[model samples]
Target: MIARAASALLVASWLVVGPTPAAQAAPATATCTSSVGPGIPPPAGLAAGVPGFHAQWYGQSGYPTLCPGERSTATVAYYNSGSRGWVNGRMGEVAYLGTWGPEPGQDQVTPLGGDGTNGSPATGWPRYNRIAIQPAPYVGPSQVAWFQFTIQAPVQAGSYRLYLRPLVEGATWLEDFGVFWLVTVLNADGTPPSPPAPPVLGTGYGFQNVATARGTFGVHLVKERLADVTVKTLTANTTECLNNCPAKPLAQYAAETNAYAGMNGTYLCPPDYAACAGKVNSYDYAVYNSTLRRWLNYNALNGQNGLLAFNGTTTSVYRRSFVYFQQQTPVTAAITNYPLLLQNGAVISSEAEQSASQLAKGTKGAIGVDGTYVYLVIATNANVTDLAYVMQALGARDGLNLDGGGTAAMWIGGSYKVGPGRLLPNAIVLTKP
Candidate 1:
């Protein structure tokens, strides 16, 4: 037997789209071919021969309009009405909001929400709060799960993304497939925010390195520079753009062209100075291609291969994305530029860079910085190489790992990329306008 229900309002809207052939209201309940909902058994048949299925809703607590805090939760139940084989699968995704576009401090990002470990746990069952995947109690397969640390609400709001999937378990406790959920939540002020005016899509391909003091940030599109990247503003003069000037800065470069090095020329900085110093450099999260090389796992941390970075409601670095910045004026602030990588303080220099040791460990993931925003990437497959590739493809100059394995998820650009997490987390959001 199959059952279904429309959220009432959605049904009403569907009726208004156009006159139905019969004009009769659509059925409120439809026969579900497979198990789908909060803690329920898989139907007679599904993609695989797993059983158990279910779904639920979660709401965030009091959060301000300019800056929001949010939370999410769901329940799962399994029964012995199906197959005798134990189930191993992943969960679905929940919708959330974020911003994107071209504006000063304007965030043009693909954000990943914030969720983390619930509490302390030494062994056996996975710790609470962090993202993970495990057998659904009495179900047919494993489901993705997550536990939010805080409620997150954004200042500007708009449709966002969410994705979820179920995976088949392997010999070593790893999953193979799962669902992807996409959802969008409203802003605190009631309505969603508008996307920023579109940027003049540039045709010529080139790199830009923008710098600024303090909290100021901006992106410059360069052309004909040797290093492939040059610093310039998209709108204002260099003088006025004391920090992020778009126009005049071009002329200033011309007058003092001799003072600056050739575009292709490399500039040297103290070796100890972090990864992004002295040069307008960037990191690319190249996709993982296992055909040629083998990915190494973390051998020192008791078989744990990677770390996590949380960005839910409570933490100061919550819900951010990666990008570059230049100040409007010269200012002094404690700034440390490096690839936003994270680790549990374990050194893995022989295999990777020392930065790898900085990844968030024990519980969740890590966070990376670009200008004023934060770029976050969570993992579903604990493969660190896979995580690095995804980040690079997403345009991260210096990437870091957020919670992964079962704890990876992202809610941005009106979409969601959830992997095996049971609970959802807040996100580093981006506004449109």
Candidate 2:
């Protein structure tokens, strides 16, 4: 009786275990079939590769042409050809798009990632080398996953390529579908649709309403080569102006100096303001008259103000306190203004000590040099800080903020490109010798 009962128990155990392996193997076989259902189909042009954690390139959005320092959205689609499902936020199962190729390059850093010391082109990336991840929570076999990310073009204009490949992070990289994004970065123009022509040697006028990550600004400028022109400061008064100072329109200053281009000078007390009741049209900054070959307000040169000087052969921008330049450099023309904008290709202006007027958004003027050329700029609807970025965009190695607001003005090629906004006690002019 004990043997019969044991045999019956053994038979019952077989009944339970007999179908378990087939049931398990059935799903495993289906997992490798490469098809999800009747309506689901494998991606076109899909090639057989890795059995698990594999991906097939499906499609992507059109490549974009971006301006330097501009951001744009991009999307890439990948069909899961692997046996496993991509699980979001899972260490081993999560899939990511990583920088790849140029041969032997896998997970390489790219300028599009903005991970370098220069700064990011786009923000909110998973990692410096990781581009993006599957947007859905799970991407099963034969399903498509669309990964979206933002790309910020580098501040240089050129064709940029980012080779990309999918990988199951912490597991294995997927097939080398050999995909890449070819992005074109154009020259700086506010809404730049195409690459601008090469910068010419002579003066030219244009309005640059640029769009940046910070905001948009409208800047009018006169660009010229320092080698082709002489840069000088022309003051209406022969000496320093205290009160009831003589001021002239920008056109007159340009006419008298035979200047091809000109802009307003350093900050001053305008007659329109009640604060300038006694000091109407008065300014205390130091300026060198090229016509007279003497420095105006020479005593004020000891203060902490940015100095821009030209010695007929080269241009120089002194950050603050030009005592050394005054004593050593025999500059033909020099002018002093508060708050240097850029130094050595970097924005150095701080709004900490700025007055409310200086901090406000209005017309702002600046003078900048890129070692090869000089730029006289007038930015509308911008502040001191914004002017710094504008100068940087103009490729200025060093820049200085000049007087602006209603006093802002710029004359180029015998016409006012920006303003004749208000009369100026002094002006910076570009003349052909």
Candidate 3:
């Protein structure tokens, strides 16, 4: 968890085009037949013997944070609810697994076809060794055919999804019901992308991306040099921001602050708790701006650790704060948020579970500073530890994680590079010069 335990401190903090045939649902015990007709249909009474296979993926098993071309093992359990038995290399009856993907992130990407990012062409199929067996044949229904496959990830630096399905090679895909695991493949090359240059917008802020052997980073730079930063906030207030709606859109925050660019702010009293989120929620949220009034979370105590940095937009020694500003300088715009990610070039402890993406990865929103430039990062696919590493490599001497999943969002140049699914309660806005 990049969220550090603060004694008292600021806390803060895609799809591919596919045949729109309905993605069907089948229980582990349900006998499912292929909706997509098979090249070879079962004959006579043999039709009843055709296998009904289903799969479930447990990503934490062997899926690692891999780079393009890196080989990793994936564990999958198959369930059979048919009268036939699965045999390895048994011609048409062998039930094996195969994977291929344009990956999910591609749907969100603006493909530069000439640069190998063509969306129409089927790509991202790893050179997989044929496994013509199901480890063991099943004699009855409701049996699990568990097996593992070692395959390589695509050679790219972005989010990806490996679509896995059970198949009989030449027969047909185990369509309708299958799993696609999201992956974050960092660049094999150690090159950070050049700063973003808007086509026509005069917003001085730079919206760019960097890729490396680590992963990809979508960076929103406030300035070229160590420009001073003034953090802005939008708490619940009836007169401002569309009645200070439970969650304001990211663009709304940018417009109100006249921000050149910005991303969603600290996590709020989620709307799912609508009974408590609207006007009468009292969940001791903490902040140390001294300029704002917030419910106290025991004035920032132990065990509550998640912190980013103050004086972010400057070239200075990285200092972390918990109960007090470690630098002794008064924190002008600080929030009581936590698990500080980086401090003076060292990575703060981060746990895998902090990011609750079932596959160990998902959308991420973060704030970081390399002591010279403050950066706002939004990742459509990645875990917390991976995100922290990407920020650290970007020269972030001090960094912190922010709310992610559905609440993560980013807007620049009057457009959302990555829009949110719902409104946001607060945001970290960048006032452009």
Candidate 4:
């Protein structure tokens, strides 16, 4: 009965209601970015490999900031290495996708919006004994399979994980190939996004609307006037870089640090290099957090400039000298990477490595300072050069290019001003003291 009910709801949700709301539409100038990447391995508890099944989770697609109790579709794809193909069986005796962990080793799930009883969650799948989504991929032995899931963030506000793994209904569980992401669901109730705390200085650092050349982009802006507001680099673990794995979802870092907003930080070591910075987990890029008072990692300039937080107060953009000269006074935060974008109000060439800039050309993330207001900008349909002009137009005294393309995104004002479509290496974030 629950399975039937879930199927009915799935049918209703699949039908086109009306025109895609403006909010649902990708920005006009947005570029195509694959939300799919190597799926991070299942949380520590998963076994090494499935004997008969081999599944590689590509990644998933969704806005980073999800509103509580809101229903949206997250698209995830995986490569199938099993002997049999996935099929939708009448009694659900075929291969299908199942949940990974509310705990490890549990290859079961209640359909979204359903209680634990009823039929298999995979029964909600639209096809019969098959798997695919629009712009379908060839799915079979060693081929790629894509699945679209309509998920709802729990009513409560927090970062939550909705894991997916493949299984053969009534037959046997497949290997523990996992695909999941940490979603930061904000509490807006039924109303517009609301800030967690009252605004500081009448306009605290959060999401603020900003007009751009193409359209209005909400920038995650931190007010220099507000005291106790801090900006830090966000990655998996706070204050340290981990080796050999991809960066965690932004929500994980934010929830851990209790940050108000998160945006992609500087580019990391070249993708082709075996080590990110000469070691798997150790960072090769230069970064420092003033509030944390730690030198996370350091490397020489790669023809790159930096965004620096000095004395735990002021922020500045400088050349390679900070590293060579060695400061007497304590420096709070220093981030160095890539080609400088804007220096002294003039646009410069991009320093992004070739690997990161190939296909994606959509909305990009950047940082610029205009007096006391430090801005995190997402330029719609712009490249690094275009981002520099954007900062100059915003009247920035100096600006630094952050990792853009798919790595681009901003979360503020209780919503994703510009949502990151991919998991990133690091981010610059704001927090309340």
Question: Which candidate achieves the best lDDT against the true structure?
Answer: 2
Any residue pairs clashing in model 4, and if so which?
A: 31-362, 37-58, 87-129, 88-129, 207-413, 242-281, 243-280, 243-281, 290-332, 339-351
lDDT scores for all predictions? 0.24, 0.70, 0.45, 0.48
Candidate 3 segments exceeding 4 Å error: 1-119, 122-229, 237-245, 273-284, 288-303, 309-322, 325-329, 352-359
lDDT of 1 by residue, 132-250 (tens): 23322323222222212212222235533322222223311222111122223344443445643433323222211121121111122211211222221111111111111121221
* Decoy 3 TM-score against native: 0.49
Q: What TM-score, over all chains together, does every model reach? A: 0.22, 0.54, 0.49, 0.46
Candidate 1 all-Cα RMSD? 22.2
- Residue 3, candidate 4: Cα error in Å is 47
TM-score: the better of candidates 2 and 4: 2
Q: Model 3, 230-256: lDDT tens per residue? A: 554444332222222445688887787
Q: Candidate 2 lDDT, tens digit per residue, 1-433? A: 0011110111111122111111211122221211111111222244322356776665555556665655555666676766788898999999989886541146766787634433444455687778887777788876777676666666776667676778899998775433556666655542333544443334577765554444445567788888888988978888777899999899999898888889999898776554677997888888889999998888878888888778885877777756544565788888889888998898985788676656655568899888888889887656688889878877778899898855778888888765576689889998998
lDDT of 1 at 233: 10
Best by TM-score: 2
Which ranking of candidates, highest TM-score first?
A: 2, 3, 4, 1
> Regarding TM-score, does 3 or 4 come out ahead?
3
Quote the lDDT for 246 in model 2: 93
User: What C-alpha RMSD separates each model from the true structure?
Assistant: 22.2, 24.0, 16.4, 13.5
Backbone clash count for every predicted candidate, in the order shown:
133, 2, 36, 10
lDDT of 4 by residue, 1-433 (tens): 0011110122223433221122332222122111222222211111122335444443345434445544445555455545444454324334456654422124444333222243422323433222223223224444444455554445466545444556656665443322344445555543333433422223444443344453333234444432455667645435555455356556665776787776777665433333344544344466665445665554343334554444444666664435433653456555665555677777665534423342233345677765566666665434455566667766676777676543556666455544444566666777777
